[model samples]
Target chain A: MRVAAVVKRIAKQFKRDRRSLALMMIAPLFVLTLVWLVLDGDDYEPKMGYSEMPQPVIELLDEETQHLEQYKKEEAIDLMKDGELDAFISIEGMTPTTLLEGSEPSVNSAVMRVIQESLKSLKTNTQIEEPTINYLYGSGDMNLFDRVGPVLIGFFVFFFVFILGGISFLRERTQGTLAKLLSTPIKRWELVTGYVAGFGLFTIIQSVVIVAFSIYVLDMYMVGNFVELLVVTILLAITALSLATLLSSFAKNEFQIMQFIPIVIIPQVFFAGIFNLETLDRWIQILSQFMPLTYGAEALQQMMIKGAHIYDVWFEIMILFGFALVFFILNIRVLKKHRSL
Target chain B: MSFINVKHVSHAFGKEKVLEDINLTIEEGKIFGLLGPSGAGKTTLVNMMVGILSPDQGEITIDSTKVPSFDLMNITGYMAQSDALYQELSAKENLEFMGSIYGLKKSELKERIQHVMKTVNLLPHLDKPVEQYSGGMKRRLSLAAALLHQPKLLILDEPTVGIDPVLRKEIWEEFRELQQQGITIIVTTHVMDEADKCDELGLLRDGQLMAKGSPGELKEQHHASSIEEVFLTVGGVES
Candidate 1:
């Protein structure tokens, strides 16, 4: 009954605080939409300038390039330097030598892609052997969004839940409601459980919306069961919530709660499989094992990207749950600071 | 024996002591006030009685049950100095939340919520979110919440802090009514006028009890014209 009361109060408060509700539900969608626009938008169009190119190659370039111009070699170099041309092509010894203004990697890749594709047509006519490519995990067609979308999903859940849960619990302390709560017959653990159960309700709804939007609306990779994805997402959220509540004790106010994000939340992103950790220093990479988001992001990536089942990703899942349990106990112990019981 | 007993209780914050070795007894069915200045350990003492804080030395008991015990907490209502309310929730919702935590049944909670709100004269604004409430109204609402569980003992830390004089009088009247209903109330206040309304008063200063007696007895003992002068005489002569 007490848990239900706390849940009811939290739900009511969420209803009243529409801005926080919108932030939880809409902020991630807004960011994901922006990411989708930038990472998964229409194919990149590279501008090409040709000099001393064969007629057939020029025709291929004309068809592929949105901005194709024939320029003298000197003029092409000037245009490339001016950033007007993505690349300049010149055939040397029957080998197509392309000079690229290679500052932006995305633009450089696009220019190389156009050059390679246009050259492939030439290869088909020459009867030269073409090398084959294969992917072990994801297909060659995968974009940046598809690769990092799983990690991003886990990240948003952890980030938003952490901030909201920390601030609200901290408010309970600053506003004196926590002391009022302790004056009742409710056990300290019951208060912790109530907070978890209360905030857990919203976390469940939040993860559902965030995960569904990322997969269905934003078209992120979703090879695994939706339920399993939600399990990881919710567990990740529980870990965030418990960790936030435990850390809130050291914070005197909401701003101090926010201060924890830099020390606690941001570092997890580095090791959460967003960046390649293969060549990183061994000790630094081992730090991933300690961060809850590492396990959350890893398990989420396993399910969403690799189509793994519960048993396949159960190790990371258990670790995330273990982090939540430890923080939950710590939260209960922290309440001892307010009431010995 | 007194219904509430605080014996040799002392507390400190770091190296600074907040409550000395203080002993006091409060009878049941009386409106007892802890009269003191802002930092006279009134809040700290009341918090100990409500089981929110445990004294560093000695003990407090309510009806032979030691404080800081769960069962002891079950029957004690505490209204903190600050209005500890969920500002986003309506007054009724706040009452319902507190009532539920005290293990009140649905029907009983509803009935008690109505009764407490009426007692505090907040029945009309029960649906308004506490954020919209005036400071005085919020205090009264906190009082109503403290009364919601029908606790036998109510510890109010500066309950009338922001209340207007008329409403403050009405709240004191309600406290008297609650005392008549056999509830023991411990109120903390710095206002001498409010202190005079208590059935008995414990004058505290700098973590020590200066005097404990009926308001009339205290005034007569000090040979003072008012409770303020009585406080000055006791607090002055001792220092």
Candidate 2:
């Protein structure tokens, strides 16, 4: 019953603070849209320049490169230096030598792909059949946004909930409401539980809106059940909320809560599978195991990209639950500083 | 035994002793004031009485029940030196939230909220968000919230600091009305005139209780004309 009052109060407060409400609900979607615009573009077609090349190779290269031009070797080198040409190819002693701008890794790979495709055709006299590709989960059309979309969703939910919950809890202490509350008959666990229940209600709605918008409106890749995805996201948010309120016990004000961003939130983003961690040092990869977002983002990726079932991600779900439970207990323990009972 | 007994209560924060060997008692149905300047440990002592803080050396009990107890908490209302209110919430919402924490039922909470708001003379602005309220109005709202649970003991820490003289007088009257109903009121203040209005006053200086008595008795004992003179005389002797 006491928890209900706290939840109702939080709901009423959220209604009054429209700006924070909009920030939680709409800001992530807005940022995700920007990321999609930047990441979900068509594959790059490198600009290629050739001088004294065979007609057969030129025809093949022409088919691969979107912007192709024939120029003198000096002209091609000048264009490459000016960043106009991605690569320049010329025949040197019957073997084609290529000079690349070599500044951008993505552009470098694109230029290599066009040159390799054209050269491979030239090496084989007989016509080669194109290999048919098949995907177990995502299709060939999957873009960078599709791959990172689930991790970003988990990250934003964790980030926003941490800030909002931490500050609100800290405000309770700084404003003296917490002292007033400690003077009341309410139990310490009830207060902590009330906070979780209160913020949990809002995070559920936030997760639903963000996940649905990402998959349906933003056209993110989703092969798993929508409801399963929400379960992971909501669990991630609750973990974030509990951790935030627990940390707020140490902070004196909102600015101190912000100090947690670089130390707490940003590191989780890097370690939460937003970037591939396979090639990183073993200890760095082990560090990801300690972060709650790592499990959440991993579960979300398994579900969205690999079409994993609920049971497949149950371990992640249990770990997220354990993190939240530890934080919730620590919150109750911290309240003992104000009131022993 | 008196209704409230604070026995040998001494509390310190790190090396700075905030309250030293403070011993006092108050009977039921009376207004007792702790008079002190800022950092006199009036708030620290008040917090112990309200069960928010525990004394380092001794214990406090109300009506024979040791404090920091939930049962005692149910009957004690506390208003801190700072107005502890949610700025985004309306006056009604703030009261309702506090009332529910005491486990007040829906109908009773609604009725009690109305009664307290009316007592504070803030009924008309009950729906206005506290952010729009002036400092005095917020202070009154905090008082109203403390009174909503109908606690048997009310501990108010400088409750009238931001209020104007007229409202302050009215609030004192309200305190008296509650006192008439057998509720014990403990008010801490530095205002001399307000100290005189208390049924009994305890003069605190530098973390020690310098004197404790009724206003008239204190004046007569010290051969002083006013409560301020009595305070100065008591403090003078101690220093």
Candidate 3:
């Protein structure tokens, strides 16, 4: 009964503070859209400059490259230095040598693909058939946005819920409401449960809105069940909420809550499958195991990108549940500082 | 037997002692004021009585039940020094939340909320958000919340710091009426004139109880003109 009162009060507070509600619902969508606009572009077409090439070779290279230009050795080097050319190919001792302007990895790969394809045909002295490309999971049409979309969904849900939940709990202390609450007959567990159920409702709605918008409006790649995606996102949110309330015990105010972004939130993004962690040191890869977002983002990616079923990602789901439970228990323990009972 | 017994209670925060070896008692149906300046541990001592804080070295009991107990908390109403209200919530909403936490039934809570709001003279502005309320109005609302559950013991810390003189007197009248109904009230204040109104006063200075007595008895015992002079006399002797 006491928990119900707390939940109802939080609902009323959210209704009155429309701006915070909007921030939790709309801010993630805004950032996701911006990222999509920047990352969803077509693959890069590198500009290639060649000199002293045979007529037959020039024709073959012209067919392979989109922006093929003829230039003297000196002029091609000048263009490459000026950043106008991606690569320059010239024959030296009857062997083709290539000079690449290699700042961006993607652009470098694109240039190599074009040069390698034309040179392969030249070296074989016959036109070889293209190998049939097949995909076991995501198709060839998947873009950078599709690959990182699930991770972003997980990240935003975790980020916003953490900030909102942490600050609200901290306010209860700084404003003396927490001390006043401890004076009442309410039990410690009841208060913590009230916070979880209260914030849990909003996070459910938040998960639904963000997931629907990403799949329907933004056309993000989704090969999994909508309901399963929501399950992962909501569990991730609960984990974030519990962790946030637990940490709020140590913070004195809102700015201190924000200080957690660098120390807590950002590192998870790097290790949560948004970036490649396989090439990192073994110890660095092991660090990701401790972060809750790593499990959430991993589960989300498996479901959305690999089209895995709920049973397939049960391990990740259980890990997230464990994190929430541990944090929730710690929250109740932290309240013992205010009132031992 | 005394209604409230604070026996050998001593508390410290980190290295600074806030209350030291304090022994005090209050009868049922009396207005007991803790008279002291700021940092005199008045708030700390009252917090221990309300179960918000546990004494490091001693035990406090109300009606023979040790405090820091849920049963005692259910019967005690505490008004903190800070307003401690949800600024975005209306006065009605804040009272309703607190009333329900005390397990007040729906119909009874509504009636009690209205009664308490009337007692504090804030009935008309009950629906107004607390953020819009003036400082005095917020203090009154906090008092109304404490009174909503109809507790037998009321512990108020500086309840009238921002209220005007006219309203302060009116509040004191309401306190008397509550006392008449056999409610035990504990008020902490530095106001000398207000100390004279209590049935008993515990004069505290630097975390020590310099003296404890009825306002008249304290003055006569020290051969002082008023409770303020008595405070200075006892405080001077201790120093």
Candidate 4:
């Protein structure tokens, strides 16, 4: 009953502060929209610069997917360095040599695809074998966004809740409401529980909106049940909110709370299965176990990318729950600094 | 027995001793002022008595119960230097939030909120958000919140700091009325006039209590014409 008051008050405050409410929901949507536009834009067209190319091979290349231009060898290299050209092909004595600007992995792949397509038309007389492609999880139709969408969903929910919850808790200290609270008969655990329950309520709507947007609106992969996805999302949000409140005690103000994002949260994203951790040094790869987002991202990928059921991802769910518990206990313990009671 | 007792209490932040072997006793049903200049540890001492901070050495007891006790917190209403209000919340919501924490029932909470807002002359502004309140109005609103729980012991840390002389007088009058109804008020202030208004004053300087007595008695003992002169003489002798 006592906890209900704090929850109700926080909900009321959120209602009055429309800007923060919008930020919680809209910021993730805005980022998702940008990602959608960038990756789902028209297929990449390679700008192929040529010093001297056979007329037939050039004519065979699709006009829409390849931008063909003639240049001197030196000029081609210069244009490639300046990023105006994806690749340059120069033929000497029926041998084709292609120079590619390999700085961007996606662009390099696009350039190679175009080069292979153009060479296929000319190689009808020769015996050229094509390599077969196979996938363990996703088919060839999957886009880059489809592969990364689950992790991005986990990351956005974690990032926004961590920042907003941390700043609000820090404000409680800087504004002296913490002192006033400690002066009352309210136990330390009660305050911690109140904060988690309050922010937890708001995060319910937040997770639902974000998950629905990603699955239904943006057409990101959702191979698992929607209810299972929500369960993981809400637990992840609880972990984020609890961890933020625990860390807020170490900060003196809102800016200090924000400083945690780059140092604390950003590193989690890097280690949370977003990047390939197998190639990392052994000790560095082990660091992922300590980040709450690591477990969240792993479970989300299992559900969204691999089409794994709840039973398959149960271990990750347990770890996320464990993290939320530890952070919640730490938050209550940290409140002892304000009042021993 | 004294309602509140401090025996050989001392506290320090890191290596700096903010309070040293502080000993005090506050009788029930009286306005006891901790009069000191800024940074003289008035707020620190009040905070310790209210169980917000535990003394490093010695003990404090309220009504014979050791302080820093969760149960003791029930009877204490503390108003810190800052308003400590949720600026986004209306005055009524702020009052209701605090009232609920004290475990006041719905009817009692509503009545107390009305009575306290009326006491602070904030009844009209109860529906307005605290961020829209002026400095003095915020101070008054904080006082109303402190009083909402109907605490038996009210510990106010510089409650009248930003209030005008006229409103300050009115708040002191309210304190007097609360005392008549058997509430013990411990008000801390650097203002000399507010200190003189307290029934008894503890003159503090540099974390030490230089003297404790009624305003008239302290002035007569120091042979000073005003409370400011009395404070200077007492604080000067101790330091």
List each model's interface RMSD.
0.8, 0.7, 0.7, 1.0
lDDT of 3 at B82: 96
Q: For each candidate, what TM-score against the reference? A: 0.94, 0.97, 0.97, 0.94
Weakest 10 consecutive residues of candidate 4 chain A by summed lDDT: A57-66
List model 2 lDDT by residue over B1-239, tens digit each: 99989999999999999999999999988899999899999999999999888789999989999989999889999999889999999999999999999999989999998899999999999899999999999999999999999999999999998899999999999999999899999999999999889999999999999999999999999999999888878888531
Q: Compared with the true structure, what per-residue lDDT tens digits does model 2 show for residues A1-341?
A: 88888889988999999998998999999998999899999989889999888788899998888889998988988988888899999989978899899999999999888888888867676777878999888999999999999999999999999999999999999999999999999888888888888888999999999999999998999999999998999899999999999999889889999999999999899988988999899998999999999999999999999999889989999999999999989989988888877
TM for chain B in all models? 0.97, 0.98, 0.98, 0.96
Q: What is the lDDT of residue A240 in candidate 2?
A: 96
Q: What is candidate 1's local distance difference test score? A: 0.89
Colliding residue pairs in candidate 1? none
lDDT of 3 by residue, B34-69 (tens): 999999999999999998887899899899999889
Q: In what order do the candidates fall by DockQ, top score first?
A: 3, 2, 1, 4
RMSD of each: 2.3, 1.5, 1.7, 2.4
What DockQ do the predictions score, one after another?
0.84, 0.87, 0.89, 0.81
What is the DockQ (computed on Cα atoms) for candidate 2? Answer: 0.87
Quote the TM-score that chain A achieves in each candidate. Answer: 0.92, 0.97, 0.95, 0.90
Q: Which stretches of candidate 1 lie over 4 Å from their true place?
A: A91-98, A116-128, A132-136, B237-239
Number of backbone collisions per candidate: 0, 0, 0, 0
